[model samples]
Target: MSGVKRKHVTLSLNEKLAVLQRLDKGESLQQIAKELNVGVTTIKDWRKNRKDIESYTITIDGENALKHRKTLKRAKLELLDNALWMWFCQERRKGTPISGPILKEKAIVLHKKLKAESEFAASEGWIDRWKNRHGVRFVSISGEKLSADNEAAREFCVKFQEIFKENEMLPCQVYNIDETGLNFKMLPTKTLAASNESVTGTKLMKDRITVAPCSNADGTHKLPLFVIGKSKKPRAFKNLNPSSLPVYYRNQKSAWMDCNLFKSWFFDEFVPSVEKNLKEKKLPARAILLLDNAPSHPPEQELVKGDIKALFLPPNVTSLIQPMDQGAIEWLKRRYRRKYISSILEKSEQGFNIFEAMKSLTIKDAIYTIAASWDELKPDTLRKSWRKLWPEVMTETDQTEDQQNNDSQEIVKDLQTLDPNVLASEVEDWITECDKDCDSYEELDDDQILAAVIETDNKETANEDSDCEEDELPTRISHTDAKNAFDIALQYIEQNPTSTPMDILWIKKWRDTAAKSRISCAKQKSITDFFTK
Candidate 1:
């Protein structure tokens, strides 16, 4: 410990945490001394500064403080703050998730209304907290008791929990689906209160290169009825011409996301593939589709109008109940982002062919990358938001009787799975496993890589000089070409590999001359001789 008693200091909570973490590690006292660049006692005194944090807890003891009080005490409001913060903390603990300003706007609306009327309101940092922001604002609260725990709350829970049980979704069949905007550009994070020469002035960047597909379910390849915007633009806003968000858009030349860009791909390309699989598997033709309230994409009104029917999830509850965020999407993204970044470093150290590079990786490899962070993305992480959201979902009816039964069944299963609450421990376990895979990459020498590039660049020289250089060796080129040509015909036979007797005539007509030519030309001759049928 440093000898100097520390002076009063003001640092962001993160900075405080960093200092505490370093101190907890029992690392170099000398390093600590050098950091504060003061006497050893200064750091020692700083440790004492942590004790002054005055651990605060709010508890209402009046006979009817629980029933009659319209507003909460400073301590009570502080408790709510702690709860919301912890709610977010749990979400973050599972994965690196954060909330943002728009969420603050929604979450603060009630507290704002309450603050305007209540005398105890000044004690609550309502405005400061409301101004809090996150790039991924997944949680918000009304500063009121999330009614799901009350008698009304209990009914709501029972409803969904009952539905979850009735469905008997067999683990795999129970799926939560939701769509999110894959923003082409992201905004920067800022502080609620601009600090006095503090507040971690260094800002963190917000944009993500890929889409975030988070769900409340577990496992891999809960592949979606993927809807891609075909327009080769960004995924949502089409009417805005290319240069609208110029300064914010990368390189000032990239296209905006559009509904048009994703429509054709979703309708034509994606649906056909999913439908094909459903047909092959003999699955029920109808699927439960979770949708958001965004008017920009296909709205719920459009679903009925278009006759492309799907079971809509309860409006806002999808974020809590939907399986997409159960770690699948986030993991998918983490894995892909890491692999993509790693690939850029390895394959195209100079520059890579993006399509060819991504294509080279197996689908499973891509899954593994995403799975790496999957566990950290858990449903419990969003429990705070879910608690607030549950009652609202219960009030809405979006189900047929059968659908209701299935949804009820799934809720029971989920609650039973989470009954004892081992979520924090499970998330920690996942983190340990995931971190083990960090920085595991193959090393490649630049010179060796450059040499391979040189070989490719010089291939023309080898081809030009090949004819004159061969001494008197038997040129096996004809034999190799003949064997390759026969292999193609043989392959066709292998699949339809059994050639008929006229096929023998075809082979004879073809093999004698066709074996020397391309499969395309040989196919023409074969077709010419075959019956029209």
Candidate 2:
């Protein structure tokens, strides 16, 4: 018996757990070792590290690994796993690319940081398992240079510091203005489709809208959004007043921001809004408006009034230094996409076809969602985003980094619950898509994938007529269209029984206004006018 040979067998995580559970239930480690054909010290060590053993939640693939009798080589480093999890998320939030080799090196570094035993080996197999456990995968990096010119970035930072110090500008006195395109039809390519059905149907080449958003450094001033669309008057807007909407709307043949429009926005919208914001805050009207030198931006050094001045970032430096590009716009897009998904679920629940519900998403809906998204941005996010460009301006008092990490976990959880078949990589892909625009503004280019400007003979004739010296006629809505709008509002109120009293009152007032406006409409084209006049 003393000379009997025992076969060497590796225990899987489950076997390890079983042995540990037996030890927990008052069974002696010696008894488990004898029964499991292992040394007593192996059982004793498993019992001593029960917390670490229990903390290792096996994933579906990990469970499959256990079924195939795979050893938990990397998973055994529970403390290192916990530490690496935190570090990985932080790096991911900073938009840092973590390749397999880079992560392996980091794991080795973290082991040294944690001062773990020299036995901690981060093998390639362990790295793959670790990635699966943490939902990490290699994604193609887009719209960012892996390496930036340090000298150029430093020179721009110096220039920014000078301008900022010269102006003695408060956080609210400084601003960043940028534009992005929202493709309303863009949906996450992941969905819970029938097993036999192709998921490629989710892709739609929908039209895009350009949105101009501006925010101050202190997160105090989020100006009203300026949304540009190809259609000057959408059918959804027929019975509505454009000026009454929360966003300022504009139309262009190309649906792109141009110098003429930028100039008008500067004088008419941006300047006035800043003045009013400053007045309310009891600060001077003087402020610094930081802009990237895009072709659409007008070249105006001096303001028509007030001491507000425009500062342009050096060419090719925006990705390295722009605050909005760092994270603000990315947060807005993520929030907007979440809202869009929420709307789809809500409308689908109310007996509407999902496609039809998505089709009903108008520019008004986009404006509201985009504005709310901008408002939801943590102030710390705004300040920290400037770290690349103006690290000196960053403050240490913000808990946004932790909050964002928590929020991302919650989002992944919610999305997984919504569609269990959804891939973790798909969620990450959606996030990467959201982050793409943060690197640069959407400049109009000849090779852009945007829709071509649709032209027709009738449209040409209308454009010609628009240039004529015709008298200004009062705008009017058709009585039938007005009635239909009122009915739709009433139906919405009826369907949403959760509507508050204030909501009902607003609907009533809107309906009454629509009715009165229809009554006061200009004389309709009549048969008598066609013959006599």
Candidate 3:
């Protein structure tokens, strides 16, 4: 397909017949070939299509195969043992580097063990497809493991299913909660050789943006529970933004986001509210709070770990198995950050200050930013936050007519559509365009595992940038603040060699400080060399 220009060139029946007639009338082979502008052999093919070609037969097995004049092929078994084959292929794919032969052997063993039967299969193709097929991504982190034995969480998930199924509790009653870290440097995926060092390096990659996100199967979307904590003067409430939760929660003492505050909010505020909201309905078999194991919530986790009745999910299952992991938090953050980014894009550096800009937004404003981003993040958000992060392809069937109608009305109002006819046309146009785009997007396989690595270096780069952005970072020169600026720059440059130009934005602030006093030009030389280096 790649190299061949024309795999098969064919003529219409009439064209073929006419060509044959011309060739039969003693026309020169060269002249006819030149006239038709086809290869000389093509003329032979036209003739062979009728007169010269003879019927032939192939015998695959025996005399019966000859009598039927058909090639008999062996029938292949369906091999319901497929589940393990799929699982093995998926796990080995994440830089695990299982060779083709090993893959085939594993599939054979798995097929036999899982299905209680074994049959030969074409190893090369089947194993290749099994390992490479896409889909299961939400939970495939480096240290994360998959096992059928982790049925406890699934059992716990069933309580949610029962709550929804009993003809009483709809998805609205169920909620999944978990915390995540969203550091400035959430590393992008890359392909690298699998090494034991990198494998264990999962534990070492410390730079992160962690926050707790919650969700349920209900159509409703709400913000994640922000427990803002701080190392210094009351943790900043800025942590609870769509951008990050910790940024807003760090400074508050009795804040709803802090661990103690979160405990109070849960036992006092959240639980009481849930009870008050639905008076007639029974409380969820128990309030199934989905959560990640964070050091901050040791009391809560320890309570669950002890004989106390809270059911926590199994280890390493949050990515694929946790519903919140699928999208709710990511949606909130992405939408929140998109606005933050859009604000940056609009200002083009000088339009506004990023820190001061976000500092002014109220909680209500921050919540709205997340709400509006729902549509954009909906692809990742599933009905149950427990499904972890998997592909959810949106379709026309996904929306009820009433929902569609409501959305249509919303578009009209938001765009301030004065003309009904124009509005109608725009709705049709937008839906058509979106459906086409959705169709082309790749569908992920429901089976494969993704073991993504979180490289540490990427976080370092982000830290370098963050440190520069906030000019309060420690300086090098003690003699004078002027030299301090240059010394700081030199130290930063030394610490970071591959830093880009935009990263040096904070240098100007130091220069401003220098102009007010006798600046140390000596340190400036070192900083300049640092940049050059």
Candidate 4:
């Protein structure tokens, strides 16, 4: 039997992707090879060509590509295919209905523009194959309607309740995760003005950052915010370690969440954080993660681990049932806006021009504010957010709607105080404005999409040139300086009559930590000095 010739087995592209996902979850190459009945070198090769495989999966028709057992073939007219796909994606994102004829016409135009030497005709057969290759379909675009199915929402509620009963899941064991867009630099669109005076408005700042907030039903654990931005290394992050920041930062050409980024976050950040939280609480590692059916989110099968599972909410009912969408994201944005407005007010009082101060607001500033705002989100607020989705989990002690409204009203009043022109209505409008055009996935422009396709075609990583205008380097603080600052803080706390014992203890702890770091950085003694000592 051992001498018999072995049959050759070729894994499909989808199978390779699954293997990569398992590898990402820390499965060893040898173990995967054993499970798949394939050679270790085969697995190694797949892992080596992981990028190309993944790129092909994304750029081509996702569904049909799954059936492809061999290496993915490049399109005959690569440039035209790339350009047409980019146009299709952009148009679809804008809710434009694209017919088959329209797509064919676009492809023909792109082929001509690309100066392809091969004679080509865009026929019905070409359109059919193109659709199959790219996973295009003529289906009603439900997203364009922007309405929830109440019946579906009710049915899903019943199904969810059944699952809850069957699993006997604890509140702390169930989690909901969602992403929201934040126009960090946006200001109120409306303002009060004198009847006789004319009001002027400036163009709205469209710069956006994506923030994903996740927490359990009981609110015992809140994952560190997963933030996505456009720049890999923003000028604002100079001299600062991104990992040291409270939020987890990632970047791409578009700051939107994609399947790859989400997959990485799930395995790396979400799983580890939840495992730690469950362990701390003496709960079982088994848990559930609820996600929406956004294009950015990977399939549930890819997200499953031992005893933990990811489930999708009923489609088109996310707005009606998603726990995070209920109020958590809105609360975060409101707090962030309040912090942003307060900063502007502080800078104005310090004699800086108001518009200049706003303009100077950097990604670094926005990140810290986002972290602080997330921290300020009360556990009760988080628990209450689940009321719409999991009413049974809500405790009587959870914050009431009136209480939340009062909190929002207070922030609005603060904003009004900061700017006399700011109206309460305008503040409320501004708080929710960032979300108006927010889609879980980013809509890439033609150039960005084409560039990605081209890179994939060339099997190369992007080599972005450095910005010509270098930002000023941030001032560095030495360990000694940090230690001295801690000492000053301790002294202030010790002398303050109003300071509590806990405050003094905290200052001492910080001072000790800083002191230890400072001592660790001290120069080592020479052999002569050691002998003399």
Instruction: Please list the residue runs of candidate 1 whose C-alpha ends up more than 4 Å from where it truly belongs after superposition.
Output: 1-176, 179-275, 304-308, 311-319, 347-533
- Best-performing candidate as measured by TM-score: 4
By summed lDDT, which 10 consecutive residues of candidate 2 come out lowest?
449-458
Tens-place lDDT per residue, model 3, 123-224, is 666544333222111223443434433464556456545544553544445555665443321111110111111322232122222345444445354433
- Looking at model 4, how many pairs of residues clash? 1
Clash list (residue pairs), candidate 4? 61-134
Model 2 scores a C-alpha lDDT of 0.63
Clashes of each: 58, 0, 40, 1
RMSD of 4: 6.3
| TM per prediction | 0.29, 0.55, 0.33, 0.70
Say which prediction, candidate 3 or candidate 4, comes out ahead on TM-score: 4
**Model 4, range 1-533, lDDT digits (tens) per residue?**
58975568888887888888778778888988887889999998988987688666766544555766367787777677767866775565344656766777777877766666888788888777667667666623433434577888889889988887799889899999999887776766443232222333432334568999999998888888999877777777777876788998887555788767888898899888888888998877878999887757655656756567788885678889899989889888877877887787687678765555565677778989999989888888888888877887778777555544665687677556656677777667667665677555765555555565566434222122222123354678777787789889888988999999999898788778878877765634355567788
Best by lDDT: 4
Q: Mind sharing the TM-score for model 2? A: 0.55
Candidate structures ordered by lDDT, highest first: 4, 2, 3, 1
lDDT of 2 by residue, 278-395 (tens): 9999987888888775656643332224377677765556777878888877777777777777776677668765455555666557767877776777777888777777776577
| TM-score-superior candidate, 1 or 3 | 3
Off by over 4 Å in 2: 1-147, 192-203, 300-306, 391-396, 401-419, 434-533
